[model samples]
Target: MKMKNIKLIGIGLVGAILMIGCTDLDEELNDSVNEAAGFSASDLLAGAYSSMRELQHEQDILASYVHSSDELIAPTRGADWDDAGAWRDHHLHSWTNTHPHIDKTWRDLNSRAFNAQLVLCNGDASATEIAEATFLRTLSDFFTLDLFGVVPRRACNEDLLQPPTQQLGRAEAIDVFISEMEAVLNDMPTANGPITATQNAGRMLLAKLYLNKAVYKATGQDGVAQPGPYTFDPVDMTMAINHLNEITGYSLEDDYFSSFTPTNTETSTEIIFVSENELGGATGNIRNRWHMTMHYNQQPSGWNGFVATADLYNLFEDGDVRRSTDIPGLTDAFGYNAGFLVGQQQGPSDKTLTSLIDLEDRPGNPLVFTEEVDIFSSNERNGIRVIKYLPNLELSADADGISFSNDDAPGNDYVFFRYADARLMKAEAILRGGTDTNGESALAIINELRTSRNASMLPAVTESDILDERSRELYWEGWRRNDQIRFNTFLGTWQAKADASPERALLMPIPAEALATNPNLTQNSGY
Candidate 1:
């Protein structure tokens, strides 16, 4: 689990986000962060980047993105995973503005934006620092726009005592993001690995922005925004393709799970941008990818919180690499696989771990993961678990010399962007009415990816095929919601979530705390 030191800084925020009173004179933290910064350019830049580390964890931001979609669910398993119905509301699309997860995500993302902007606002920042900071700020804004349909902004030296007055609506935010990112693209250096900000990473963001422009451009009520049955402009699609074409120096990994392993930075060719994690650094809990779903009696005992839906499991055939398969590192002596986990699980010394907790349906029996799951109430055996990011078992109890445990941090760099997703976006652009720059047909690109994944080739491709392919390739990567939203299938009923989501669900409600602090924020209507 080695990485370039530049990519893995101590996860600590170089210094505290200076606190101030929100009085007639003092500028408080509630309105802005890094308001009274006197830190070095390096310290501020590193701090800016460090704020993103928390994104890799589930139960909040990533959970909201995934559990709201059809691919994942956090069913109430008897006494565990019932967080006051927070997980269930996400799956059922009944979340209010005050939803803890939604509120936390908004604050976390805003902090990221503020820290990056402080670097830009600082007089000492070099050109390279500015470019990287610009990318970080835009990335934070893009997420805010996508999730909440608005982004609050304080100018370069806005008064800290006053709340943020500028609120960029979705469409306007899109315009500013494109302009800012494009302006700095050439200033950033090419990255040695996916960890550092680079021109290619900037291009990837541009590609995403262009592809989703039409959706953001949709004008309607702030809260009850219309879910897309919208148009994909050929111009925007072509722009998306052009930006994708500019992204270089990455390729699809032949071994699909290698892209997410603990040593992925050394082994994988697919990663384009990642939140670089360190064994004893970075704030993100990457181990939760496995720990969130696995049973208490499994090899590395877990909280048994969430699972992949049966509908998503049914999408794949037996031979696909993306489908659950016995992984070399993860499938240790006890035998666990990389993707969707089902059937009886094994623990230490090849023991079949039994359900220690008295689950309603299967008490004192083998810890078997059945396909059936209900959000309101379920047993430990009700849902098929997933393990996308596998831990480095060399540090496990079995290994000699090196020491590790479930409590120790895992050095799995959480994926933010990968070449496979970019390639898929290119195919999506072509399907949406753009001609491929390299004369690559949509079917050819689709089939080519399938061949790499060991899945059967399709005779042709359609929008549905593209969406399904996205599901298979990018499952459990915190992108299912964005992909589902882009494909216009997000609101549709599926699996444990029986009812179709409302149009108002398209935009998560602006948190009440934000409204109280900033006069610019308008709550999305349904809340």
Candidate 2:
């Protein structure tokens, strides 16, 4: 076993921590060995891209832990178990100690970035791909910084052996990442199409970079400090507008379910940044299928995890189509009717009471009561299961299997970015600036999203309404925690979630193992 050092490049056993954060700090981190091989710049860039994509595997597992509710399931039995709704505790502990996933992604991204620096810094690539690589580097850092908070910003491979230099905390925040990202955007090539076989062509990366600018400032008290070089700046609002305006030609499907259908072509419009999933790939989207949804057929016993919370379910307005799109009232997949009800106690044949859900009811949004309503396990995810990226008909045949490679899953790119996100960002920026910020215009941008849901359009939007809209629109896409934190509402309690969840929960704890490995490092508050 190699020495487990937080600052040193994570390799093999010490890698899983970065996977929790998807920092790419850990992946492809075997620089000691890789460097001696002396690969070409193109080879390095492609390898890095491959490593960056590994997060899909790690993210699928972590996301599973997020949806399990206290009310629905009995406590899980193991320390590394998902029963307590805190499987992340294991991720935090394992971060820098063992598990190569984290180290693999980090090393992969860093290797790519280092390769880009070597080529660009030395004038190797023609400057266009260099711009793309630079954008990737900043993006890789953004993922690391957002999750880990303080990460090494090494510009070259030579820095690998050096002690992990500490980067400033979110408290000393500058829009450095955003600024760096924007500077590269102007120089990089634009997306020729939604799907890219040869080039990176997604709008989500850019949208996400700007989308969080406001939150980044709001978090680090440094933005609001007086007489300091750092101050909250509204310039990001324009960045939000410009980047969003540049992305167009995508629209919502007539039915949200269309996007989730097996062998879906609609995903071309819905997904912006899908990681490539190879056929029979064990560590890919199936993890998502297994972790998030109940596969009574696959498990034999019953669905074991990821029930949505009552509070999260109620966030949807009545008649909003996304409630069904984001989460299903029951368990099971397309053809397994028995195990698909909302509150069934046993398997479909053993079913007793019909599964009923209260979150779907509203003064304005009453249930339409179609046969589509599922009533399976009593724990049929009292909330919705994520429906954003199910397999298309081509791959739908194998959907029930326990493991599938990238090629066997739906071809729809995992939508990391899209127009809907941009529009929401605009709505958020407008609401943040004040009542007159966009005047009637803000409502136009936000309400367009609601129009599809068949919900009432907001003649005017307040910050509260925008927050509600984001919860409705972007629920499982991974922005919930960020939105809650940005608005300073992370610590607040909802009906289902208790007050014990605090603002500190907004930022994750530094993996305990990470601190142990690098004794020089300190844990984040409330760890």
Candidate 3:
């Protein structure tokens, strides 16, 4: 067979297998091509991009990280989200090697890395195509290192059936990842109002890796797999700041909610890299952020599984616009609060919502979401629900013009890197004993963000204050686990959690399935 024919066959095989696995079989089946015999290099590159989307949505990876951090929690509401206690295990930091989500995320990310490698191996690809594939592979590798403390390694020519893929530890992996990103930085295109691999995206990724390099290299508290007592190398910190400063032509959105609306891809100026999701298109799972948290009685009902803790809610000052509660009676196009939902709930019709009697531990009153959660006997509506990403509300004219009440899939592009994050990280690096070009202090940087959000300027800043700012700014967008770990706060007691087993709980254990499939893998300490 010709090389193109072989590559096409490989693409078709992978697509068919993935189609069978994705829950929305109808959509995936429709997307799966009958054969890849006539596919071009761009078609293969598009396949790689689609695989990257899978990494974003698969196995609840985003939710797992949010729940594990201080900002959010997945409480078992009677019987709604027990999930074999998997949800609670994250908040409690007690997940085992066999944790289903952990294993699924591992497989999903590695599969993307491998698929990207396959695209590169097909010698017919152009230089641009090669750069794009390398970008995708590096993205997967970055996540693998961030979450698992190890990066799975395989060459483009490696056989799929190989039993053991080599692994690189955190320090080695960071060095290699940085070098790879640097090589492709200039080749990546700048965004032209559409999502694509870009120079800004590359710089943002490199900045993040450099900022966390100290945590990646830290070693202390024997048998504890947590981040520092970090040694923030001045060179790495300078590089992080310099890379962030180089990115231009983006700024913070005036309205905090604008960045997360259904039309965020076009509205948000802060986004540098995003997972492009379209409701009826070939990609986009960003709607899960909304579907997973809102109450069932609300318009576009949600799973009602995840809730923000009082600690996170309390971080917002009384006048802070980020707190959805402060914006009373204001609703988005979706008729839901723009941020956190608390107290009495309202639907699109402006009618008060009441929980069904059959709901576990029903309160028999208006559905009131409290900041406090009992963890044991909390009512079905005890915790404050999040609506950070507005629910999909577009109604088809042919269908009585009623909005989608429960869209399991939404189209808002999920932002992975944004300018605000880069700004915040710059602030953090300065605070952690690094200097800036203009002699800006960490407090000044933080105040700039606060002032933009209409929040009160703080008199002074501390490490704890910076962490709180991070939660307030970046909550539900991911980065909580990493922030917590980097600050040595992951194992601390918070809300309903106790600081038990702080050391070993920092890094997740290598999934049992991964170890079984690859003999070269070893479990993290204190599994």
Q: Model 3 off-target regions past 4 Å?
A: 1-39, 219-226, 325-336, 348-363, 398-406
- When 1 and 3 are scored with lDDT, the better candidate is 1
Q: How high is the CA lDDT of each candidate model? A: 0.77, 0.44, 0.71
lDDT of 3 by residue, 1-527 (tens): 00111233345344323311323334433343334424666777776776666655625557457878888877777777888987778888888999988877777777677667656777788777777778888887777777878777765544434543567787678888889888878877765453676788888888998999888777443323444667788889888888888888888777877777667878888888776666655545666687677777665656777788888898898767788633333363334467777777654442322221222223456777889886545667889888787756655445543446335556677778888898899898887766688677889889999998889999999988898899999987888988988887887888878665457676777787667656677778877
Q: Give TM-scores for every candidate, taking all chains together and pairing residue i with residue i.
A: 0.91, 0.69, 0.87
Evaluate model 1: give its TM-score.
0.91
Per-residue CA lDDT of model 2 for 1-527, tens digit only, reads: 11111112222222233222222443354553355235444544444344444445534323322332121222232322343333332222212323343334344443434433443443346556566566656655665556545544433443343334545455443366655555665566555343231123323465565556545544444222111122324565555555555565667655654443433333445544444443333224533543444423322222334434455556666666666433332233232221122332222222221332322222333222221211222222233333344543222234553333343443443444545666787767655542323344677878777897677887788767887787777665555655655555554544333434533444444555455444444555545
| Candidate 1, residue 518: lDDT | 68
Q: How many clashes show up in model 3?
A: 1
Ranking by lDDT: 1, 3, 2
Off by over 4 Å in 2: 1-37, 58-85, 88-123, 166-168, 171-174, 195-207, 218-232, 257-267, 279-283, 298-303, 325-386, 392-412, 434-440, 516-520
Q: Show where candidate 1 strays beyond 4 Å.
A: 1-36, 221-224, 350-362, 395-407
Write the candidate numbers in order of decreasing TM-score: 1, 3, 2
In candidate 1, position 482 carries an lDDT of: 77
Clashing pairs in 3: 277-284
RMSD of each: 4.1, 9.1, 5.8
